[model samples]
Target: MSTLPVLNNADMYHHYSDVQFRDGCSVIHEMLKPKRGESILDLGCGTGRLTMQLASLVGDSGRVVGVDPDSCRIAVANEQLKKMDDIPVTFQLGSIREALPLGPFDGIFSNYVFHWFERAERAEMMHQMYDSLKPGGRLTFVLETNQPQPNAIIRDIFRLTEPNLDEESASGMKMDVPSVWLQHCSDAGFLVELSEVFRTEKAGPNLDAILQFLKASIPNFQPIKLTDDGLHELDSRYKTGNGDEVAFSLTVLKVLARKPQES
Candidate 1:
């Protein structure tokens, strides 16, 4: 919520549509198989792609609330949902770390969002989520697992820009292992239901396509400060096996936990 660098609207819209949001929606839907007449909350629901899908899943008797920190993204999401009539949906501009307005939802879902918060803040956010859920309500989150290749790239970029990049540059919020996230959820009093790492590969036909993908999937790439030489270096490094495309594997951590019933 602080004055972080904002994403370019046009570029982000293109990137979101072309790369990130589609896959993210699929992952979230897979994790949350919503049923009819069930209340749902979408944490960090950028552009409302999943939120709208959730609305359809929940039907007229149910409600869906989407929350995000960026007002621009929320505005876009609202505009997208306006075309549809008579659907129960709400969008709020706020950080997930803070208290949420609506509570006791049947399910809480998020994708590619939690890694943005600091470790302690993430723990607190999990606690807030736990309190927001009804007894036996489900909480599921999909986040990037800290892997060697991505971490090396991130470190190199930060080191190139500024030798003494702080915790922000290091992305201290990202959980190094799946166990760490599961531990945090368990510590927050959630009954751990499922937790595991999933790996998938994405391919781009060219360097431009790869850059577009990164712009959408990697939030920090939005604020990149790269020298001309650095830019060229990156281009040279990311290439495909056939030497005609750019392909890379992304490692992810998927977790499903539930709020405990009181005695």
Candidate 2:
């Protein structure tokens, strides 16, 4: 796979996580239900915020391993680890496609991460997660749903400025609906525990932040750089009102699946 769009922009991503994705932690915490003395893996753990949180739940006897594909993010994660001397959390630079050899974990926790996997690789990812877990290990996560409204809004806004941009190439992210995810889990030998779809809103980014996110996180949008005047125009057109924060709506999918014990 080509390099991730956020590979070199860890600081911006850390900021994005804090402001936009932090609120999802409550749902993740409730779903994962990590136990003390349990081994957990934080897959796609960008900058290790959630990983540290998991470590706290697991306590001194347990350990949490955080893995991500981006080196810069991993570096940031390691830096954060310095302040977490009591938490048994470690960050590794790796991709999910590797089927991570560090395994037999009691639980796996990911937040807004699975959708980053390519659609074609998702089944394999499910299998890998299954293999990485001990029997009855749980995989819990929340990610953007495969609903079209969000993507459509992005495409529509970009098209206003660049009419030539194609729909298929506008986004690098691959989100899927719950049914599709359930099928993958079943195929990988997981017993589905819970699946829910929900909606949430985040403060819409301004043009400067939007441009940074697109350039740093959206591969398809990277090549289509917006001019200064065009960006200002799009911001004027899309932003809600003067001095008001724009509302960005997202449909989210939450799942808790477990590897079935040997019969």
Estimate the lDDT of model 2.
0.72
225-254, model 1: which lDDT tens digit per residue? Answer: 667787666556656567666555667788
Q: Could you tell me the lDDT of residue 35 within candidate 1?
A: 84
Query: What tens digits encode model 2's per-residue C-alpha lDDT throughout 1-263?
Result: 41223456777777666543565477556888888999999888888888888888899999889888888889988888886666788787776544367767999887877766767777777888888899889998887776755523456555654567554355656766778888988999998899888776555556556556655555545525566666565666557674634445668788899988887
Candidate 2 clashes between residue pairs 3 or more apart in a chain or in different chains: none
How do the predictions measure up, each by TM-score? Answer: 0.81, 0.85
Candidate 2 versus the native: TM-score? 0.85
Question: For model 1, what is the error of residue 206's alpha carbon versus the real structure, in angstroms, after optimal superposition?
Answer: 3.5
Best-fitting candidate, measured by lDDT? 2
Instruction: Give the runs in model 1 whose Cα sits over 4 Å from its true position.
Output: 1-14, 17-19, 97-99, 149-173, 209-233, 241-244
